[model samples]
Target: YCMSPGIVLTNACDSVRLYGKLSLRRCNMDDDDVQWPFEHEVLLSLTHPAGEAEIHLQVDPWRDFGWYRKPSESNNMSVCYSLRSVDLDELTRDGYVFEDQLRIKCKVVP
Candidate 1:
């Protein structure tokens, strides 16, 4: 599993875009046994309030152009999504954002 501490929201062509980074790390216990260049499909979804539908995004580490391989202790990749991917205003109006906080669900797919 990976975590994105911050997501950058910017205005682009009359719409909004979200940019963030995802990374993989070498765990102390599993580094030796686990394979290098961690390649797993990760699904991230923004949860909606009152059991509404979620906004989903998929990340494939294998397509990151060698950035997925661990050089030192961790490897990183950049990710971005625009209106073509998701609607920000619609999500906000639907209660996806609450108290200035957004809920994101992550799932690792092998």
Candidate 2:
């Protein structure tokens, strides 16, 4: 698993477009072992108050996993993922001024 941190911003009344880059580290598992390749998935969970809109940028895991595969498994081993909408239109009535900040937690799992 890998941990990445980044900053995102959204317009006060408009749907915010979240865009950023995340670099995942390669696992140190040995090369010649039967488990020569390790596969994992990345899940993004975003939370905001009621009446807020959520948006996401599409990313290709197969291409992103290029740096994580073993030398011999480089072409054959890759990561795959699916985007599941946990919830949408969650009601949030809070208001904030410009420069106001909020926190959301993100995690990557195997």
Candidate 3:
């Protein structure tokens, strides 16, 4: 698990300050062209000094592999996850804020 800071802005100059951390656990995946089940979690914390701000999370899979194919064809293989929505306030109330703990499950195919 690692911690990082991110800034999100809503409506022009109006921005809400928040922070989140990512956790990556080892998952079992077969070495074949099939989707495997994987699980992970993300914790976040949002603070609004004015008490009128909204916070959102963006989850993106960071791939560390590349594809190889014939040069004549455009062989571009990339796998990533899009940002998913998670209620920050609800998560915070449940003690799943930044620095806290959370769990997420997913499936990957290759």
Candidate 4:
């Protein structure tokens, strides 16, 4: 088993485009020894009282990398991603500005 250590947002918590990066770190929490080479897409979903939208991004750190084998037996590892051309501020500022807490959500793409 593994535990998601939450997400680290870049650029002082401001919006990001193709220039920003996000890192997701997970730690080993169970019988699994030497976890590696996992493939999955991460979706960044933005939700508001009015509506919501989801965007998919590559994570092997970024760009759909296959076979990301990180030899970590200690339980510290991370996945990074390059932000797409989406602007968060503009998305939320359409009418109601989202309080920082209700901004975005991170998920493992299914």
Please tell me which predicted candidate would have the highest lDDT against the true structure: 1
After TM-score superposition, what is the CA distance of residue 21 in candidate 2 from its true location, in Å? 3.4
For each candidate in turn, the TM-score is 0.69, 0.35, 0.24, 0.47
Question: In terms of TM-score, which candidate is stronger, 2 or 4?
Answer: 4
**lDDT of each structure?**
0.57, 0.38, 0.35, 0.44
Model 2 ranges off by over 4 Å: 7-16, 25-38, 49-60, 63-65, 69-99
The lDDT of model 4 is: 0.44
Report, for all candidates in order, the number of backbone clashes: 0, 4, 3, 1
Q: Give candidate 4's TM-score.
A: 0.47
Q: What is the lDDT of candidate 1?
A: 0.57
Give every collision pair in model 2: 49-92, 50-91, 50-92, 51-92
RMSD of 2: 8.4
Q: Per-residue lDDT for 2-105 in model 1, tens only?
A: 44433556687887765433555444555566544345556777777666777767655555466655545453554422223555676677788788777777
Pairs that collide in candidate 3 are: 40-104, 44-98, 59-83
Model 3, 3-110: lDDT tens digits are 223333223234332333232322243335433222233323343433445354444444333322111232233222235444445556645444653333222232
By TM-score, who's the top model here?
1
**Residue 82 local lDDT, model 3:** 36
List model 2 lDDT by residue over 22-107, tens digit each: 44344455445434223444444344434364333333356445555444421332233333222112212233212354344444
* lDDT tens per residue, model 4, 1-110: 34232334445456543222344234654425633324455555445646645444444343344313443453434545434544545645653245544445565555
Better candidate number, 1 or 2, judged by lDDT: 1
